[model samples]
Target: MAFDYDDNNIFAKILRGEIPNNTVAENDVALAFRDIAPKAPVHVLVIPKGKYVSFDDFSANASDAEIAGFSRLCAEVCAKEGVGLDAGNAGFRAITNAGPDGVQEVPHYHLHIMGGRMMGPMVLLRD
Candidate 1:
């Protein structure tokens, strides 16, 4: 069964500090933690600290601060992981799964920063 992106979700509880997380980075607007089910070497899930049911929900409810923080957080993670170097910093990708059609299993919105080793071609889940 699909899970609702509501207060009861595990991520929501993590955000609320009701549960522990392997947080890699955190700012006022968002939190970055290692994905329990990692897809890559440096897989981190960046989730807004505030209430955001999904990508659309976050996009709609997020203020300028939140948006800027989210973008900055992505950059911060990339730099911290050294995913951008000439000798090669390797490569990186930021992913945000949208609605149900996008295969977003989680209800809460999050940015997936995946990189470290060479990654394969992008597979756009939606056209």
Candidate 2:
């Protein structure tokens, strides 16, 4: 599938500072913030400052610095939020949903950090 960046997307607006967010951490290449609709006790989102429709798109198009910075910011945010390795072996879950099947609600690529409690299996098994 072709990945196109949409300037009008909500994340793009947030990156542009056109919309305010509950920012957790931010650097030159990325921003981390509390998810408005959190699925876990500690839920945060890390997004690239640039336009990226999916993880694949970001990984393929973004510069090495951008990729590295974005990754570092994700770990930094998780640590700052108290879900770091010190929190226990469970650590935290950093996930990115891609495409329609993944239920990606936004067009921009983002990582969701979830922790602070035990999580169930990634998917439900159907008979």
Candidate 3:
């Protein structure tokens, strides 16, 4: 579905307490919630608290602290969810689709972290 970009994105609304979500984690700079449509058992969408139209927008507007916070938050969430670093040899996949051409259904920049089960290779449309 094409994400609504005119109004504040759904995720941003969620962040602003204007909407509800199955939140998994939250920090000053980001929020993590379950994907409405999950591709894996533990699929969560990690979104920046700050609103950005797209990945490119985020890249341009995000500060070093924002970038570092996002990186650390990913690791922290993965560990907390026991998705990759648990004793079970389980692993996780983190994905972020950039633009419409990249399959980004949402205009808001977010990261998808999937785990609680093993996943296949990173190749897309490959044998």
Candidate 4:
């Protein structure tokens, strides 16, 4: 019922240098790396370095600098991957899941940057 943080999560380990990651970009507040099981051409996982359970958690508790840094890092990822609208590219998708219903596999605040092709429907309608 609480948005608790797990320091031993994979992302946490990656941040702690316990696990290796193909880093794309990073700043004092976050780290962006290629996903191990990528679902798209540019599947980068951007995670805040702080201990937060979800986006809401990070957004609510993070300092202004961390928020800004994380956002800038996300934009950097899109730009570096050539998926931003500033380019002639079609663009990319940024996804963040929370809790069980959202199917968040990790208990760390993170954003998934997916692009390089049409992603189809955002989600299939259950109807």
Candidate 5:
């Protein structure tokens, strides 16, 4: 199936200012905000202003500058939330769930910055 961007998605609305978000950081290419349902002590969502359905879509369509700026902003959010490498902890995890199997809830692409505590393994092995 072909992938298309849905402007009505919550993240898109947030990017368009149609919805309110607790913004943590922003740049010309992307915006970072605290997650409404946080999975960790420091949980932030970083999304690109451009239209992209998944991480692969964004990586394929977005410009190098946009990608770089978005990455920098994610790092900045981690640091600002005290979950960066300098934080005397186990560091943070950046995740992007792609497609249905990955359990991506929103159609728009986004990265989840989760930290501020020792995170468990990303997945459990099935025996």
Candidate 6:
């Protein structure tokens, strides 16, 4: 399946140096930076430097090295932000929204790492 990647998206722009970000950590395959509109005290966004529309798109096509590098970068961000289990307090939440149903604001594949406080329930029960 073809993944439609918009080169003009915000993440894409950030990757191309068209926009600036408070970079937390970065490597050859991914970049981790603070979120502009943070929902948590330590809200960081991790995205692949390569073009990807969503999690599945990345999972289906990312090279093994890309996956390893991206994962390592995320771990580095967590440690840098003091939000990982080994860092101190409680752990952080790693999230990735997919499509419209998931309220994905950006078209690029990214992970949101939130912590620094009690996050409460993962999702409200919709009954």
TM-score of 3: 0.83
Residue pairs in collision within model 6: none
lDDT (CA) for every model shown? 0.82, 0.89, 0.79, 0.93, 0.89, 0.91
Question: Which candidate gets the maximum lDDT versus the true structure?
Answer: 4
lDDT of 3 by residue, 39-64 (tens): 89889888887767666677888988
**lDDT of model 6 at residue 52?**
86
Put down candidate 5 lDDT per residue, 1-127, tens digits, no spaces.
5457887999988988899999999999999999998999999999999998899999998999999999899888978988888666569999998888788889999999998888899887777
lDDT per residue for candidate 1 within 56-107, as digits (tens), equals 7777889989989987887887788777454367678888887766778778
Better by lDDT, candidate 5 or 1? 5
Task: Quickly count the clashes in candidate 4.
Answer: 0
Q: Give the local distance difference test score of model 1.
A: 0.82
Prediction 1 TM-score vs. true? 0.85
Candidate 1 clashing pairs?
Answer: 5-107, 85-89
Candidate 4 residues 49-116, lDDT tens each? Answer: 99999999999999999999999999999999999989888989999999997889999988999999
Instruction: Please provide TM-scores, in order, for all candidate models, with all chains considered together.
Output: 0.85, 0.92, 0.83, 0.96, 0.93, 0.93
lDDT of 4 at 44: 97
Using TM-score as the measure, name the better of candidate 1 and candidate 2: 2
**lDDT of each residue in 65-126, candidate 6, tens digit only:** 99999999999988889888884658999999988878787889999999988888999867
